[model samples]
Target: MKLAKHIKSALAIAAIGAASSAQALVVDGVTWNPNALNDFSATDAMYESIVSNIGDVVSGYSLVTQLNGTASAVFCPGCELTMTFTGYQLANVTLMADLVTPDQYFFTGGTINIYVDSTPDADFTDPTTYGDGILFLSLAAHTMGNGYTLISSPTPQVGNTGNGTGYLDVVGGSAASNFNTNKYGFAYTGNTAADFLFTSQFQLITNDDGDPVCLSSVNDSPICMQGANTINGNSIPEPMPLALVALGLFGLGLQRRLRRD
Candidate 1:
């Protein structure tokens, strides 16, 4: 009876751990550190565009410039550029961008259009969709026409920052842009802590002229750049999936101890 009780206790603890692990799906990739400003801006820091042609699971990692910042902050019509992120999964998708220096750098503002495999409410369970799956943005004191616009701070969404984070219709224009190379994409955390799986930190200007800058030579366009990325789901080994490991270990240990007894 004592051995049976011990085994049952271990099994119960294992089950609980498994349940907690379900909180999020894990994704494997080069851990992008926001604090590593210099490394984050380097060409090697951006998420590599995963081509769908291959048997790759996740889709393309692309960027669309909705509007090219002008001498002022007004977005000129017909100046927006859109880049489709192919093979995009509905799970937690985190997009990141950064600028360096302020010379020739103008106010960079824009909307990021996100097309998920599932609906907003279905994918991210949240009272407000603002951060759940969509986000709006704006930044002040943003100078335009500069070579690099360094991110000294993490600016949240705002009215004039751009437009509201609305549902992206399959046919209509899904995103807008105010700044060219300073915008980014991330999951909404206002809902639940589980929704925070795909969060990204910001790194300020690290190197001077050596700063990593993503730029659009044409002013309004997705800046073509190369970088390495490894995306793994919670099913993979990571903090998000640690519960599964603990449960397995506990179960195995319980079995061994019972056999010995």
Candidate 2:
């Protein structure tokens, strides 16, 4: 009996070590992360269109939920709001851009669209349909490394202007996030059905290698990455705050010690 228990412990340790190995998913020649493991729960997906043939789910992962920076965390109904996030990698992907050279850099990105409804009872359970929520905020983001975290400060969702359908316009950031790039946020003009970013973390994780999956053999191929993710759910300000960080903020001897989960 003791021998069997010792064997299990040894196996568990070996598994952990193996998973720690630096590994990512790839398809053909593109290294794209897959949300297959999480059962296709990518709220917003990113892709690189090299002139054409743009795949929506370029191995997408995770969902989104923002928090209000307040003590009571009350829902003001029509108060102005701002958003900030320490992003994370729900899945890993691989893709070589056409302009990417030996030492050149490339990009893969996603989007977040918002809506406003004065109904007072807005429901966003369905990001696609937004159950009861109306379109109000819409923004796009891009990343260069495995994951991204916005600057420690909060900005408004006024990027590119002439639009207010979406927000979280993080077009550029880095891996370690040791530098404050051109990361800015947006805000609602008069405020009403819109405020800071909403909700708790939720998502589905999957492999990105375009392998067999939960509903494979049905014709189409689903590509996902190997990793865990959050269940994407949008919401208004609740009483209690949600802390969805995994490994805490990366604290190296560098720039802003932003959250790296």
Candidate 3:
């Protein structure tokens, strides 16, 4: 009886420890464990373009005149970039961008689209055809010819930065499993005269509208969002721990019956 009681007590302690350890999920200083479900999104914008200059000024003895300053260049009208992350755990994931542009030109009109999914061994070859799970798609107007712009989506929706650096806290979900499983895609539309230049980053975080915690980049970082509430997926509990818990409960019940007898 004494052995049984001790076994039950030990099991109870073990269960408590497991629950406490998995209570909160933290990534890049952002707490993803939320009592209620929440979604966050943001975007960053920049500029990139090719330029060619022609003509020079010539001085005359009697007349003063300004010569030509004509230029022409080809820019990237539309392009798609996709990234697949493997062996990374994520939940309450937020799409982040750090956009950079040239000094003279800015992103006139375009959209930055984001897509995410947990399908194992998924392929993101073509944007038009590869449409499985899309979290959020954002749109923005011209920035009044500003050199740079920083923005976040779904929440703030519009950004008001001119340096081409911004952050957004968008979407919430669990981690993706399997090798080469998780995939992210980016589609960019540049202005008529110039192409947009920028870089993107992803982070695992909860709602930050009240208290914002922004990240510049999540590459090569051991931070990802995962679990229930955030990703609508079952958190895999350790079998050993569960088995031990069950055994402990059985011993406790047996001890009680013996006492009753």
Report the lDDT tens digits of candidate 2 across residue range 5-64.
554555555545444331323211112122223211122221111111223222222222
- Best candidate, lDDT: 3
Candidates by TM-score, descending order: 2, 3, 1
| TM-score, predicted candidate 2 vs. hidden true structure | 0.25
| Backbone Cα, N, C clashes tallied per candidate | 41, 52, 25
Write model 3 residue lDDT over 1-261, tens digit each, in one string.
677668667767777766765554332222223222321111211111111121111000000011011111111012211122221111121333445432322222233333332332222122222233432222222232232233222122122122222111122322211101111111222232211232332223334463333222223232222111011112222234565567667867777787788
Superposed by TM-score, candidate 2 places the C-alpha of residue 20 at a distance from the truth, in angstroms, of 50
lDDT per residue as tens, model 1, 61-128: 32222111121112212222112222221222123444442111111222223322112122111112
* CA lDDT for candidate 1: 0.26
Q: Which segments of model 3 are wrong by more than 4 Å?
A: 1-4, 20-240
